[model samples]
Each structure stands twice: as C-alpha cells, then as structure tokens.
Target: MKNASPRWFTSSYSENGGVCVEVATNLAASHGTVPVRDSKTPTGPSLAVSAEAWTTFVAMTRH
Candidate 1:
C-alpha cells in the first residue's frame, strides 16, 4: 500500500446517534487488510484486520 492512505467512511445504514465505527476498505486490495477506527476519534489508533477476516465479518453481520 505504498503512498496510499485510508479512506474512512461509515455505513449509510448507521443512524445510531453518533455511535459508529469507520472502516477503510480501500486498502484491502493493496495492503491485504482493512483499517477500522472509531468515528468519534479520527485521530485515534486504528485496528487493521486481514482482508479475508474483514469480508467474513461483514457477511456475518448481514445475517
């Protein structure tokens, strides 16, 4: 992920009174991971999960 930056965004379905997490899936292909962070703290530390793990997590949430 050379020269690439995280493009964080919250899901459009999120409407829970400002309590949401942001995710940057844009780096998944290049970095093999997805960066996640709290929406209220953009400058805080982010957690990076493997691309496959992130995919599985989202799919589970849909069910």
Candidate 2:
C-alpha cells in the first residue's frame, strides 16, 4: 500500500455510534500485519501487531 491512506474497518457487531474501533485490512495483506486505531480519528496513529499476535489478542478479547 503506497501513495494512499489506510482503509479502516470496524467490527460488524458494532452498533450505530458505538464502540469506536477501526482496523486497517490493507496492512494485513501487504505485511501480514494488523493495524488498529480509533475510528473517530482516521489520520491518527495506529498499533500494528503480527498476524498470529492479532489472532491471539482477538481470542482473548472474545472470552
């Protein structure tokens, strides 16, 4: 991904005006990484975690 802004996606389970979380799917494909940031600020800094790390974090959050 170059010469462009990152695309962020919120969880499908999120309700209207709720749980402001956004993730960049593009990062996953190019670098095998997951970039996450606040949906409220699209241009803000994000945290990148490895694919395996991301999955493990999600599993922990789910439980």
Candidate 3:
C-alpha cells in the first residue's frame, strides 16, 4: 500500500507534552471507513472501522 500516507488529526482536548492518538478523517470521503492510529509510531499499523462504529466509539467514550 504505497502512497498510503494517511493524514492524522489530534484531539482538541489533547494538551500535554506528548500524545499518541491520531484520527484520519481522510478516509471518510469514502463514507465507509474510518482510520485510527498511534502518532508515536507513524510506521505502525492502522485500524479501519466503519463510520458508524467510529461514531459510536466516540460517543461512548465522551462519557
């Protein structure tokens, strides 16, 4: 999967010296998958979930 440079975005709530979570909304253009990764390891593997699953995860974690 060359050229698979997923752009990542950190959480607005993140405000520390360092964090490792990044969400790639670029995959949302497909309206099917959402990409999640660890910024600490850019070369690390990524997980792609359905948009609905991603939304649910976010909502549940908000509490």
Candidate 2: regions farther than 4 A off = 1-5
- Which run of 10 residues does model 2 get worst, by summed lDDT? 1-10
Candidate 1 or 3, higher TM-score?
1
User: Per-residue alpha-carbon lDDT of model 3 for 1-63, expressed as tens digits?
Assistant: 334546788888887657758888776655567888877877788888888898899999989
What is the lDDT for 35 in model 3? Answer: 84
Error of 2 at 39 (Å): 0.3
Sort order, TM-score high to low: 1, 3, 2
Q: Candidates' TM-scores?
A: 0.93, 0.70, 0.73
The residue ranges of model 1 lying beyond 4 angstroms of the native Cα positions read: none
Per-prediction tally of clashes = 0, 0, 0
Backbone clashes in model 2: 0
Ranking of predictions according to lDDT? 1, 2, 3
* Per-residue lDDT over 1-63 for candidate 1, one digit per residue giving the tens place of the 0 to 100 score: 286899999999999788999999999999999999999999999999999999999999999
Cα-based lDDT for every prediction: 0.95, 0.79, 0.78
lDDT of candidate model 3 versus the reference: 0.78
TM-score: which candidate is best?
A: 1
Residue 2 in model 1: shift from native, Å?
3.4
Q: Which residue pairs in candidate 3 collide?
A: none
